[model samples]
Target: MKDWPGPVSTCWNHWIAVPTGDQAGVMEVLSLSSPTPITFAEAQEVIDADAHGNPDDRHHLSRVFVTPEVDSWTLVIGAWCNPCDSERHEDVLRLCKALSARYGGAQAYYYGEQGDGSAWLVAEHGSVVRRYAATGELDDELLTLGDPLPQEQARRLELGLPADGDPQAASSEQIEEWTWAAFHLAPEIAAAYGVSPFTLTREAKVRGTGVLALTPDAASHGI
Candidate 1:
């Protein structure tokens, strides 16, 4: 994570922390805050009514929205599990890398473990960000506005996966399977928008270029 200089504003204020099991209710609050008063049951109905079908949709509903207090505006998503843990950390890292490469750096932000066992990635361009952990906190400073994954780390991320596979190699069914696993393993954030899961997996390969294409330029050695 890139270090901020001084007393940054508080972005945590815009974040609405919901209980582990209250994701549906929270989403309802967000969705139904208009003229109509939506009750918990009504919100569940709307979620269930989606055409894609809900196969345990509850797991995909965990998340909070953060509005930053400083110049570098951002929304931070906390990781539900320890990012260093072999289980889902790699997936989180991969997604951040792809997002950074696609957006040209500083467009997204991610933090792993440090302050808390939380990892969050933000894509400010879309006005949509996802958080998975219960303890993730938001900083007040919105200093940089591009890729949060540094050049060095981005280079490593670009080399971590294969780039020559078939574009249609992973079928939707296969992708769905991985999505299900991701939702279950980290049941604190919603992984899908429509039929797509927010996090990318080996099987899905949603971000096109693959590992090699995303890598940064080699450093020049000075004599």
Candidate 2:
């Protein structure tokens, strides 16, 4: 195990689950088409009206980047809110579902910011399969969420997290280098989500350990 890197900035934590594929694999399936840009006048006005604008700043729906080491794609949306905001949460879900549908119903990952309590969700089509909330609340409504392997479950059991606690605290225990967790996505499920399970697993192994999963068994029950 490597030394714990002090404390992380909880103001913006990331949560993501891509079609069981490497960065390239997931990226290939995802629609990376840039969000329609605002008209030049509107963009300039928004930037100028806000005293905070810098000459280089521009308005956009979200900013995107790839973590090749983790085999996931991340998007930093302009919307910001606390975990308890139902409106924000719903908006996020809608966005995630749309993203998933773009890839022919493949599973999509969403990592939303909520100050020190970020949230992550894995969705197929419009249905949420797995949810990991950092707001000290456990979401068990989605039973279709997949299962973790024995080793994954056992490691989660060892964490012994507290009720009404942040799942990331438990996550810190399992991380080595940059890895969080990786779940074995089933082939059929992957197909439903329009992805290849074989490629997902292959990419995960090749990427080392930046990927991770928080199943209902571990994330909700802390088992």
Candidate 3:
């Protein structure tokens, strides 16, 4: 395997199951639209490697996997980001829109910061039914539409730690401990939340506290 340069910031993993009949069509569409040309086997390999090599940074790999499903298809995309830039945030949104347009029922998860963030988006026929964001500390509105702001369930999960035990809590070590834990646990809960595990992990670190507590729009979207 080749070693990547620079501080690893973002990673993504996605899986989609299509009908055997549509397998060829799905591959063609993904190949044509994606910024990079990746084969099904290659994508799987990347996921496996990232999952094992650095489970913590699995979102940075930006990997996607597709397979054969029943009638239509199922898609899953995962991502991770560094948590400082905004351009990376936009790239993730663009990728989601493109894939959702190609497949009927699609879902996406974005993680990480602005410039070095990672994201994943996938669909079966042509519509996006689910979306998730794990990016730590950055803006939540960048990934979703409308108001109401999303809630960071991943963050909540992390905060679930014993209030006094959490480093961010009054009796804890740091104020951001709860947030960091959230980002770390994001990948583990990605499937349940339909969001990027990596992004959630990063968001935990920078999420604010106190009277100005910010909630992820996803939280209000009904989880």
Which candidate ranks first by lDDT, i.e. highest? 3
What are the per-model numbers of colliding residue pairs? 18, 9, 48
Question: Which digits, one per residue and each the tens of the lDDT, describe model 3 over residues 1-223?
Answer: 2211111223333333232335445445444223243433444455546544644432433434333222233333332221113534444444444555654334444343332233333333454433334345366435544211123433444445443233243435333554454344334434443423223232222211101111122133332
The Cα error of candidate 3 at residue 29, in Å, is 4.2
Q: Higher TM-score: candidate 1 or 2?
A: 2
Candidate 1, lDDT over the whole model: 0.26
CA lDDT for candidate 2: 0.33
Candidate 3 deviates by what RMSD? Answer: 15.0
Ranking by lDDT: 3, 2, 1
> How many Å off is the CA of 144 in candidate 1?
25
For residues 21-131, what per-residue lDDT tens digits would candidate 1 score against the true structure?
232232232331212323223323332342123424422123222212122222222221123323334443444444334333212222221232223333332232333
Write model 2 residue lDDT over 20-136, tens digit each, in one string. 434444444433332333322232233224223331332211223232332333222222211123434555455456556653332322222232332345566656554433333
Worst 10 residues of 2 by lDDT: 1-10
Q: What are the runs in model 3 whose C-alpha is more than 4 Å off? A: 1-21, 28-65, 70-91, 101-104, 110-178, 193-223
Comparison by lDDT, 1 against 3, better one: 3
The local distance difference test score of model 3 is: 0.36
Model 1 C-alpha RMSD vs. true structure (Å) is 20.9
